[model samples]
Target: MHYESPVREPLVIGDKTYHDITRDVARPIETTAPKMWWIAFSIAMAMFLWGVGGILWTIANGIGSWGLNKTVGWAWDITNFVWWVGIGHAGTLISAVLLLFRQKWRMSINRSAEAMTIFSVIQAALFPVIHMGRVWLAYFVLPIPNQFGSLWVNFNSPLLWDVFALSTYLSVSTVFWYVGLIPDFAMIRDRAVNPIQKHIYKILSFGWGGKVKHWQRFEEVSLVLAGLATPLVLSVHTIVSMDFATSVIPGWHTTIFPPYFVAGAIFSGFAMVQTLLIITRKLFNLEDYITIQHIEMMNIIIMLTGSIVGVAYITELFIAWYSGVEYEQYAFLNRATGPYWWAYWSMMTCNVFSPQFMWSKKLRTNLIFTFIISIVVNIGMWFERFVIIVTSLHRDYLPSSWSMFSPTAVDIAFFLGSIGFFFVLFLLYARTFPVIAQAELKTILKSSGEKHKKHHSDDNHGHH
Candidate 1:
C-alpha cells in the first residue's frame, strides 16, 4: 500500500510570498480567532498589575524585608540579579553570535529573545537599585563628576564597572531590538485592523515601505549591531562574575569564573527561552511555526551548555582541593556539608543531574518531559547562584563572623513578584507583536521547499 502523506493542508507554495508570510506571522507568534483576543488581553493585564504591586511593596518597605543579615549580606537578591542578567545574555547570544556564525535559527527567535533580554535586564536592574537601603540615592552608583561631595564613584570598584557595563549593554540591546522591529512594524502598520494599532505601528516603523534598498541598509545596520552585541553579552557576564571574582571572598575568587559565568548565562538564558516559548506557541496557536523540531534543537543546546556548567562546578571543586588553599577548600566543603547543604545539593541535582537526562533521544522529544526539565534547570541555576553567594559569605574565616541567612517574607514575595513581572511583559508582547518572527519564518519555509524539491528530483533520477 502507498504510504499516506503526513501532510494535511498543503500550503500554497510561493503564493503567500516571502512578504506575505512575514506580514501574517508578524502579528503574534500564533494566530488567534477574533474571539480569543479578549482572553489574551485580560491575562496580560493581570500579570502586569501583580508585577507592579510587588515592586511597590519593595519600595515602600526596605531591603531589610529580605533574607539578609550582617554576616550573610547576600541572598536571593544577588542570586536573582545574576540569574536575570544571565537570562539577558541569551538574547544577545541568539542575535549576535548566531548572526556571526550565519545561523538562520537565530532569525526565528531573536526578536522575542532580545526583548526578553531587555525586560529581564530591567528586572535585574531593579534588584541592585532597590537593594540599596536608601533607594532614593541610586544616583550614587552613577559616576557623574559630582560637586555635591568628595565621594567620587570609585573607578577601582567592580560595582562601578557593573554600572557602566550594564548601562551600555541595556542601551545597545534595546536599540538593536527596536531596530529589528522596524520592517516587521511596517507590516503591522499596513495590516492593522484599527487606527490606533496603525498609528502605533506607523510611528514604530518610522516609514518603511519594504523597499529593497531599505532591507539592504537594514541588514547592514543589523550586522554592525550584532557585532557590538556579541562583545556586550560576553562583557556583561564577565563583569558580573568579576563583581565576585575580583573579591577577596574565597569561593568567589577564581580565573575560571569569567568563561564559566558566560556559559552558565547561556544555559539559564536558553531555559528561560524554552519556558516562555513553550507556553507562547501554545497560547498563540503557532504549533506549525515553533514546531517540535524547534524544541528538540533547544533541548540539545540546553544539555550542552548545562554540561559545560556542570564541568565548571566539578573543576572548581577539583581546583579547590588541588590549590591547597585552606579558605577555598573550606568554602567548597562548607557548601557540601554546611547549613545550606540542601541548597547546594538541590542545585547539583537540578542543574547537573536533571539536564543530563536530555542526552536520551526519547526524552528530548517529549514535550512534557522537556518542560519539566526546563523548570528544573531554572531552579537549579537559581540555587547555584544562591549557594555560591550565601554559603561562602555566611562563614568568613572567624567563627565570630559566621551566620545563617534565610529569606524573609518580603524577600520571598519580591522574588515571586518578579516572575509575575516577566510574564506580564511577555504576555503583553505576545498580544502586541507576533510571537514568532515572521521574517525569520519565511526563510525556513524557503529552505523547507528547497529540501522537498531536491529529494523529489533525486527520486526520479534514481528511478531513471
Candidate 2:
C-alpha cells in the first residue's frame, strides 16, 4: 500500500514562456469523438425538454397532479431535491476542501467540479420551486413585507431557514466559482482571435495581466474563499439535514442525520463527478492532465465515502434497534420488510455492496467498472433518500392514517427530465469551457511541497 503524500511545491516559469497545454502530457486535450457523443448530447437535450414539458404539465394542471398523497407529501420532489443538493457537495469539496488542504491535483479537475456545483444547484433549485405546485405563487415561500401585513418571514421554521440558507449558499458558490475563473478567462481572452469571443473574454478578464503582485494577492483571495466555502459546504448539507432531523418523525429525529447526510452528499457527489470525469477525460482528450493517478485518487475517496455511507446506513438501523425505541425500530424494519422493501434493498445494493468492490485496486482501477459503479452508487443514493423520505412518512403513526402513494406520469417524467436537464447543461459547458482549469493545472505542475520547489508567475498576467 502506497501512502500518497498530500504536499504540493510551487513551479516557476519565466515571464517569456508560453504554455503548450496540448503538448503538456502524453495525451492531447482535443479528443476525437465518436458520433455517439453527439447522439448522447441530443438525447440529453430531448430529456431536458421532456422534463420541462412535465413541469409545465404540472403547472397547468396543479401540484396535486402528481403521486404525492397526504402521507407522502414530500415524496419524489424532496427526494430529488436532496439528491441533487448532495451531488453539489463534492464540487465544493473538490474545489474548496482540497484547496484548503493544498491538494494540487484538485486544480486539474476543480473547474469541472465547480461547474458541476453550479449546474447541480440549478437543478436543485428547480425542485422547491416546482414542488410548490402553483409554481406561479411559489414566491409565497419568499419573504417580502406584504401588503397583507408587516408580518415578517418565519424565523422559527427550518423550511424558511432553507429559503435563506440555500439561496445564500448558492450565491456564494456562484461568486466564488466566477472569481476563480478570472485568470483562466484572461488566458482564453489573450488567446482568442475571434472578435466576438475576444470581446466577451476581455470584459471577463478585467484587465488581469500576469503581474506577480496581482498573482500573489489572487492567491490570497482564492485561499480565503476556499476557507469560507469549506465550512459552507458542511453547513449547507447540515442545514439540509435539519430539514429532516429537526422534525418529530421517528427516523427523522436522529442526531446522526447531519453527518450521515453530509457523508452521503460527498459520497454521491464524488460518484457524479466520477461519472462526468470518466467521460470528460476521454472526450476532451485530457487523459494526460487528468491522469490515471487522478482517477485512482478519486476511487480511493469513493471507496472511503461509499464505505462511510454504508456505515451510516448500518448505524442507523443498529441505533434504532439498540435504542429500544419501538417507533425507530419499526421505522427501519418497515423499510426492509415493509411495502418499500424493493427500494430499501436496492439502495443497499447500489450504495453499500457495490462500493465494496473498490477495496480491490484491480476493480477500482478498471475504467468501465469504475464508471458503472459510480452510476450504481448514484442510483443507490437517490433510492436511499427516497426510502428515507417516503417510507418513513408513508405509514407514520396510526395504521388507520397509513397510506401508499405512487408517482403519477408527471412525476416520473419530471424526475427523468431533471437528469436530462443536468446532463444537457453539462455537455454544453464542456464544449465551451476549458473543462480542465488551465491556471489550476499550472498550480499542479508546480513542485511537490515536500520537495520545496520555487514558484513564479508570468509578468504578462493581471494588472499591477
Candidate 3:
C-alpha cells in the first residue's frame, strides 16, 4: 500500500506548493530589502522625526503651544487618541473574533492586521502621555505608592479604566502576534543563508520544531489566546466610550455609546486593513494569497458596520429629541446646524454615504474604489471623534464660556507625525516579518486554489 498526501486546489496562487508558501513569505526577510520599501521607510522616518520635534517643542513650550482653551481642553490630542484606538480594534476582531468563527480567509490578513493593532496602539498611547502637560510625572496616574504621599489613583474614573484597558490590550496583542509568528520564524530560520539571520530567527522561534506534539500545543495555545482576546475587543472600546458616556455633558452622556463605538471601531479597522493590504498585495506580488475575494468580504463588513454606525447616529438624534432635554436636544441640533456642522456632515458623508458604494459588487471588488473608500472611512472616523469631543464641549451650559476650538500647527504636526510613526513601524515590519502566515495558509491550500479542484476531479474520474 502507498500513502498519498491529500490533493486539492492551491490556496496560494501562481501554482504554489507548501514549500513555495514558505519561500514566498520568507523571501523578504531572507533577501535584501526592496527599493520601494526603503523609499517608503525614508518618507515615514521623516514624518516620525517631524512628529518627534513637535512633541519636544510642545513639551518645552507647555500645553499652551497647542490651540486648546479652557472651553475646549480636549481637542486634537484626545481625538487622535480615540481614532488610533478605534483603528487598533479591527486587528483584534480579525485575530480573535474571526478565529473563533473559524474563518479561513482571515489567515491571510490577520498577521499584518495584528501588527497594525500593536503599532496603532503605540501611537494611541502617545496622545494621553503628551496631553498630560507634565508627562514626566505620568506615573501618578498609576495606583502606586507615591513619594509625595499615599495618594491613590481614582479607581472610579473612566480615564483610569482606559489606562488599564489599553495596557492589557497592547500586552495581549503583542503576545498573540509573537505566538503566531513563531512557526513562520522557524520556517525562515530553516531556510536562512546568513548565520546572523538563522540565529535571529532561531531565537525568535523559541526552537520550534515540526513535531506532532509541538503542532498540537501551538493550536491549543492559539485557541486559548483567542478566547482571552475576544472579550477584550468589546471591553477595551466600551471602556474608552465610557470616558464620554460616563460624562454629564449632553452629547457625551448616552447609553448607546458602547455598541456604537465598537461598530465604528470594526468599521474603521477593516478600512485601515483594506488600505494596507491592497498596497501590500500589489507591492509584494502576493495577489494569489491576498485575493480579490478577501477584499470583497472585507468591504461587505465595512458596508455592514457603516450602516450600523449610521443607524446609531440616527438613534442618538431620535433619543435626544424624545428626551425633551434642552441641553441634549441642542447638542444634537448644534452638531447638525451649528458652528461645527461641517465636521458632522463630513462624518455623515464619508462614513454613512461612502460605504454605500460597496453595495455595488463591481465597486466593492474594485481595488481602487476599495482603497479610496478605505481612506474615506478613516477620515470620517477621525471626524466622528472630533465631532464627539470638540463639538460637545465647545458650547456648554454657560453661554459665556462658549468658544470655537481649532488645532494649532503643533496639533496638526503631531497627528500627521503619528501617521508617519505608524507607517514607519509597519514598513519595517513588512520587510523583516512574514506578512502572511505560511503555516496556516498551507492548511487551506487544498480548499482554496483552482488547481486542487482540477486534481480532485481527475482522481475521481480515474477511480470511475
lDDT of each: 0.80, 0.81, 0.91
Residue range 1-464, candidate 1, lDDT tens digits: 21212232221233445665665576463345444546654665565566566567778776666778888888888888999999988889988998998765566677778889998998899888878878888898886767687768889989889999999999999998888887677777887777887888889889989788988887899899999889889999999999999999999999999999999999999888888778776765555556666677788989999999999999999999999999999999999999889999999999888888889989998888888888889999899899889998999989998998877667766676677677667766777776555654564554453344454456668998
Candidate with top TM-score is 3
RMSD of 1: 4.6
Work out the TM-score per prediction: 0.90, 0.90, 0.96
Which 10 consecutive positions of candidate 1 have the poorest summed lDDT? 2-11
lDDT of 3 by residue, 1-464 (tens): 21123452244566677888887787767778778888988999999999998899999999999999999989899999999999999998998999999887798999999999999999999999998988998898889998878789999999999999999999999999998999899888898888998899889999988899989998999999999999998999999999999999999999999999999999999999999999888878778889888899999999999999999999999999999999999999999999999999999999999999999999998999999999999999999999999999999999999999878889888998999999999998988899998898888777665567566667878998
Q: Over 4 Å off in model 2, which ranges?
A: 1-18, 22-34, 446-464
Top candidate on lDDT is: 3
User: Any idea what lDDT model 2 has?
Assistant: 0.81
- Ordered by lDDT, highest first, the candidates read 3, 2, 1
Under the 3 Å rule for N, CA and C atoms, how many clashes does model 1 have? Answer: 6
User: lDDT by residue for model 2 over 110-176, one digit each (tens)?
Assistant: 8889899888988888998987767777667778866678767778888888877788878988888
Worst 10 residues of 2 by lDDT: 9-18
Candidate 3, lDDT over the whole model: 0.91
